[model samples]
Target: MSTAHDRERAWLLVTRREVVSRITDKSFLIGTVLMVAMIVGFIGFTAWQEERTDEATLGATPEAVAMAQAVADAAPQVDDKLEVRLVELDDDAAARAALEADEVDAWLHPVDGDWQLTSESSEQDSLTAATRVVVRQQVLADNAARVGSTVEELEAGSTVGTEFLRGDAERAAVAEAVGFVFVFLFYFAALVFGMQLASSVIEEKQSRIVEIIAAAIPLRHLLAGKVLGNTALALIQLLVYLAVGLVGLTFTPYKSYVPALSGPAAWFLAFFLAGFVALACLWAVAGSLASRTEDLQATSTPLTMLMLVMFFGGLSLDGRGQVIASFVPPVSAVVMPKRILAGGVDWWEPLAALGLLAAFALATVWVGERLYRRALLQTGGRVSLRQAWSAAE
Candidate 1:
């Protein structure tokens, strides 16, 4: 019998081999570089879009010049990025010419003691809204002055304030966005790495290399090594992506969201580690049960379906359903973090969820090892789960 120390060394060797081989692989390195580039490029593009300003020019006849200037001055108050420039026109004819020549986005002229605004195509909403606001303010001020009062005095007690009885709306919106990122990361890592692990197992079994390896070390150690090694790689890749994304967020208006997201982000990583181990073990079992690459699809369908359910559940679940899901293993891996970020969960909630996930992960490891051990040396075609379970050890 192998000593405990020997078994530890044995699995470590397999794990080191797995990690080293993947790190040295050109495709993995290239893929990592490409993903990083994409993240940086996306963030850069978003920041550029946010910083870009929209300019609108309005042509105004002499009688409407004051109204046009008022619109220009007030436009920025509504949207800081909006700049409305006034182009003084000699007459209505001149204003029409400016509009035709694209010298101004719109034209303003006085008709029947009211302003008539015309644009070449559909009216710009920003300019239109600004014009409405300016017109309303002018009318209100005139009325207030006629009554021997100020606009502020006339509009006193007219404004309404909002109060949130539960979580903050703005913070919850940010948390939802952050939760989406976490869901995508978890789904992507589980699908990609899980399939890769499954494929690796099937490939080794098909090549009969597992027979030689199984003889020298326990099959349980082999399974443990592969699962842990891939889990490590997945975590490293996730960390890199998250680090790049967080650093990129600093360049955008959403930088303030980072500090609030930090705690939930940490919890996501912890849950992901446990959740992925469980999924990875089942993937290993899926591979061992399959005799060839073509057979992998049939064997892995259940795992795929489970992942899909988790993916959608993470995004769509809310209300009492969300609260219930937050306690379930694997599903809780995504749901609990989202709830924490959205607020209202007790302090012990995540801890309890994580405990359940950890226990589930351990159970999967034990069960997956049993199935993997029985099926690893089977030489014929695909082995059914029942056959693998009943087969002699």
Candidate 2:
């Protein structure tokens, strides 16, 4: 009798071989480097947007130099990113020339005891806000000096109070963006690795590799090993990506903003494992159904379309629908993690979803075994699902 331990060792050897093969591939190495670069570039872009420190050069004529200086001094109070560097312009002609040259974002002119700012757009938000505050303070100071009063006393005008009403549904926009990455990453990973899984199976079967391997181990063990191996690779790929993202986050202004995403990240990985396992089996089934590499697309279209629905459906659905989707099998494996970030997910919700997903994955494995067993070596042409299902064992 084949003991459980012997079967474990046998399947483990198969899994180890697949993992080694995938990681050692030249394409995987190259792809990892490219993925790293892409991750860095995206992180840098997001960090730049959050900082908004793009310098806006200011050409200040002699008359407005003092006001510009005042604004520069008050820049810290307005916005840390708001930088004002004064460029001395000799005359109006020079100022216009500076503007034309695009050497300055705006020409600051003092006309008739008021500041005039000439820019491409009327709305120069940082400049406008800083100038207004400085001007208001200047006016108050002048009045205080004339009346023998303090600027603070004169500036104590009517107050406007503000408050925010937050609800349970109100999640940070940044959090949702992070969650989208998690879900969408899984969506993409499933498609890519799923196809890879199918291709791997097809290649082996075509080369008669599966027959040689199956002569020693049970076909089911070989199947389990293949699934386990590829699934490990898929997970490692996601973890590498997730690690890169988290590390990248630390360098970004979003670092502080998105730290709370750890909870969602954990949930994402949990669902990712289950979802990919289910998808990976179908991928293997697709491979089993196809006779040649050319037949892969045609045979796998149904399963490919199924995952595509999860991707597109995730984009269109929200709230109750998304919540409902979290519990559904393959969809649950992708969208539910995002729902955890996007809404008030109950503690029991993930447990229930995971349980259901586990059951579905097991069912998929059994079906995948059936498909793989009946059709894997019958490689004269593409095998129909009906024929594979009803064909004699």
Quick one: best lDDT, which candidate?
A: 1
User: What lDDT does model 1 reach?
Assistant: 0.90
TM-score, one value per model? 0.92, 0.81
lDDT of 1 at 223: 91
Give the alpha carbon lDDT tens digit for every residue of 220-297 in model 1.
Answer: 889989998999999999999989988888988778888877788899999999999999999999999999999999
lDDT of every predicted structure (CA atoms) = 0.90, 0.81
CA shift at 330, candidate 2, in angstroms? 1.2
Candidate 2 per-residue lDDT, tens place, 131-227, comes to 6787678768877999999887865776676553332323456666777787678877888788888898899988988887766677777788888
Q: Which candidate achieves the best TM-score against the true structure?
A: 1
